[model samples]
Target chain A: MTIKVAILGFGTVGEGVWETLHTHHEYIQKKLSTPIEITSILVKDSNKKRNLPDSVQVTTDIEEVFQQPVDVVLEAIVGKQPAYQYVTRAIEHGAHVITANKEMFAHYGPHLLELAKEHNVWIGYEATTAGGTPVIRTIDQMLQVNQIKSIQGIVNGTSNYILTQMTKHQNSFEDALLAAQQKGYAEADPSNDVDGYDAFYKAMILSQLAYQDQPNWDEVYLEGIRTISSQDIDKATIQGQKWKHVATIELRHGAPRASIQPMQLNEDHPLYNIDGVENALSIQTDLLGSITLSGPGAGKLPTASAMIEDLLYVFQKERQQEAQYV
Target chain B: MTIKVAILGFGTVGEGVWETLHTHHEYIQKKLSTPIEITSILVKDSNKKRNLPDSVQVTTDIEEVFQQPVDVVLEAIVGKQPAYQYVTRAIEHGAHVITANKEMFAHYGPHLLELAKEHNVWIGYEATTAGGTPVIRTIDQMLQVNQIKSIQGIVNGTSNYILTQMTKHQNSFEDALLAAQQKGYAEADPSNDVDGYDAFYKAMILSQLAYQDQPNWDEVYLEGIRTISSQDIDKATIQGQKWKHVATIELRHGAPRASIQPMQLNEDHPLYNIDGVENALSIQTDLLGSITLSGPGAGKLPTASAMIEDLLYVFQKERQQEAQYV
Candidate 1:
């Protein structure tokens, strides 16, 4: 069976997914033992003068892309408007959905999950958290046997980039931020990443997965590394500590609470060694004790790799569902 | 639809699996939907004193345990000979297999995997590596999308225990080994662990999983920390390094080669921070870059947690297969 996929954005993640597919084409083909076609691409500008394959149908209208023949809608768009409509419509049309949009998943994950179930499909957002770390898959499987008590990690790459630059290059926050932008690690307006909103959204997604529900995103307080000075880095170094931007999801009593903040972690802490764009999650559980997973937080190949993982899962689930009918 | 199980060797891992089933009884019920029943146990002594429920039939003869009404065999036995016998027999009997035995799996993994496929059942060995870290599953799922380049980390707990003891107490190798034996971390013989055979087995298993075939274990060199001195530890410490029992599986050109030895790693290395009985694996892949998973590599609860993970995978596979057939 062929799994038809629609790329809802032509951004970094979307392009990376395309390039990865092109590079590891044969490997994935052999592994899946089934064909997965990227059917259509939804872009804001149809004539953007970008190189796209002749087989891929490019359209500016979201509905045009959503109405195309597809088994799964892959949303790589940045924010919530057309992405929300396109995804919902794809699900309503009975297509499976896979996305890297943390903002949408963070806000409407449970509702979307219910929608997917109601429509007899699956929604994947593994890339929404820690890029290609497999934290989501691990938690999903682990939760089947063990009760996850808490999740703590460095979930933001921009904040981590700044902190790492401060440590490695003796750069101040402004210098680090400028350098990150120059390196294309940070956006022109970097509030989303540097002000902890990015991490907060990821925390919300993780909380949903861990608790099987969403937390109040507004109530989850965030403290970004915007205030972290060169002096702070020196002080942390002198005190044998690391200034790490930590996103945490833990149970307060029986309810889940999440927060994003920069913490002074001692040398013994796992997050202390997680420098730069590396993401690490320490999952404390009832049955399994503490299991920590660390990997690249964000990159072209990494995030693209995550989408491919979801594709395999989607195919597996589809095969299983088809078997039920047989 | 109950999974009838026979546990080989009602020892630490077996009892832990049993107790875990009881501890998270309701959760397992909800997840499995169907239940699991332990039908028989093979032990060295029929008169061996162990707390057992009435429904659990105990046996002195290994062959007798395989003849019982068992659909899955949990081989918690710690050797190569009888474990290989029981697992091969169980597969021939059309039973699934889950084991925590590294040595057995390392030597005969590919053959058993083929046997399992021929018998249309799964052969699970998640607990063979880093216990509850979910390293194997992560590789099976996540790295399937990417090419795994190299695997390296601290895979042995006993060696780690002795090294950590040496670092913490400033004890010599012999003294630390004595302390580890006293703490039940090392065996009375200490040959398998301290002599690096245990780590060798783990590296062999890792090579099989990472390479999708059995590596020539005989071609791999082995080294232990039994020769490591306090002076080495002090030198490493002075150089801001930590001594760890590192097991490495590297693909040189095309073929796989592995090594298990005491390596002094600097702060830049992930294994530098993984001390004590904590085991860690760093999987460098083409797509996701580098991913590291760490957890309790040994102990009753942690190992049992891994077994439970295997049980969940088996259950999920069964469900998927059932869905296919219906």
Candidate 2:
């Protein structure tokens, strides 16, 4: 048997997914006992020059991609608009959906999950939060036995990279952001990252998973790192501290409260040394003490790796179900 | 339906499991949709005073505990002899087994896994490796997509605690070992922990999971922290380094080579800041670069938390299989 997958974008992450599948094709095939084939790729411009095999279908029409039965749909398109629509359609089509769109997942994740449950399909958004960190799976498993007391994370790599540059080089925030942009760590317009929107979205996703409820967007205190000055960094350095943009949510009075802001961390802090583009999540639970997971928060291959892992998980479940019937 | 559990050995970990189950009784019941009942507990002496309720059956003979049908068997016995025999019987009786016996697991895990597979039962040893860190689950998920290159861990909490004392107070190895024993972190005869056997066992477990193969015991170079002096600690500290009893396994030339020794870690290393009784595992993979998980290595609650998580996993899988037929 062969598993069919449809790609919803041919951007960096889409290309990454394709490349990863190609790179680890032999191992993946052996593990799944089924070859995975990209049956269709829905791109904005089908006429764009591409370096893919001619046998694979590249189409501009979503309907065309769904014409054939697709076991899975991988959506890597940015923003909420069509990505949400595409994901809903994928679930309706009885195909498991794996998405890397944080904006779409953060806003419509709960609703989509309900829809997936109704359709008896799975919706995987592991890449939507901290890329390659496996925090989503960790939280899901831990929630089975632990009441998470609190979560503190450096989820936005761009912001962390900027802060790291500022602390290490004594550079101003503007200078640091410019350096990040030059190094391709930050985008041309870095508001989503530096303004804390990216971290806020991830925090919302985590809150929903951890608490099974989320604080209203208005209730969250959102603060960006743009206001941080070099003097602040110097003073923090003198005090054996570093400035980090931390996304935090805690159960207060039996309700989850969340915030995203720049905070000074001492040397003893688990996330204090998580510098550069690295991300870290420190979870405190009632049973287990503070447990922290640190790794690459964002990148092409890392995000792709998360999506691939989700795909593998979907297949593993399928295999398990098949084994049960046999 | 109530899930029947038989606990073998009423030691520290067994007591912890009992306490954890009592503390989270309502929550676990809701999650599993079936209350977990400790139907039997095998102890060295049934006459020994225990704080458990009278409803639970405390037995001195293993056959008495197995007289009734047990859905799960939790083995907290420390040594290889009784634990290996009990685990084999449990699997043969078609019950899922969750064990905290590292020595038994490190030696016989592969064979027991094969036995469980033949019996169509599950065996969970999450607590056998890194307590409360979830490194086993993390590695399992990562292995689906990435080729793990290397693994470095501070797996033995007693050794880490002794080293942390020596580093912080410039205490002699003997003095630190004495302090650890006083704090109940080390045993009266601390050779298992201090001689690197505890870490060596965990390294073997990690190697088996990562490579699906184990290195010969004789091939592994095991060195303990017993030889380190206060002078070595001061010299390393002056050079911005710390001595860590690191358990490491790497894919060298397409085969795993493992070691447990005191290594000098620089400030930038991921495991450098792991102090006191904290445990950490840093894994280098092909696709995801390096990721680290750090938390409490061992304790009553932490180890119990791991066992409970494994129990939940067994129930979750059972639930999934049932859902398939439904």
Per-residue CA lDDT of model 1 for A14-50, tens digit only, reads 9998888778888888877777788898888787898
Off-target runs (Cα >4 Å) in candidate 1 are A320-326, B323-326
Q: For every model shown, what is its TM-score relative to the native structure?
A: 0.97, 0.98
Q: What's the CA error at residue A300 for candidate 1, in Å?
A: 0.8
* Weakest 10 consecutive residues of candidate 1 chain A by summed lDDT: A317-326
Scored against the true structure, residue B115 in model 1 reaches a CA lDDT of 88
- Interface root mean square deviation of every model, in Å? 2.0, 0.8
User: Second chain TM-score per prediction?
Assistant: 0.96, 0.98
Measured by TM-score, the strongest candidate is: 2
Model 2: per-residue lDDT, tens digit, A1-326?
79999999989999999999999999999889899999999998878899989878899889989998799999999999899999899999999999999899889998998999999999888898889889999988888889999999999999999999999999988899999999999999999999999999999999989998888889999999998999999999999999999999999998889999999999999999999999999999988888999999988898999999999999988898788889
Q: Tens digits of per-residue lDDT for model 2 on B1-326?
A: 78999999889999999999999999999889887899999999878888888888899888888898799999999999888999999999999999999999999999999999999999998899878788899999999999999999999999999999999998889999999999999999999999999999999999999998889899999999898888999999999999999999998888889999999999999999999999999999998899999999988888888999999998887888888898
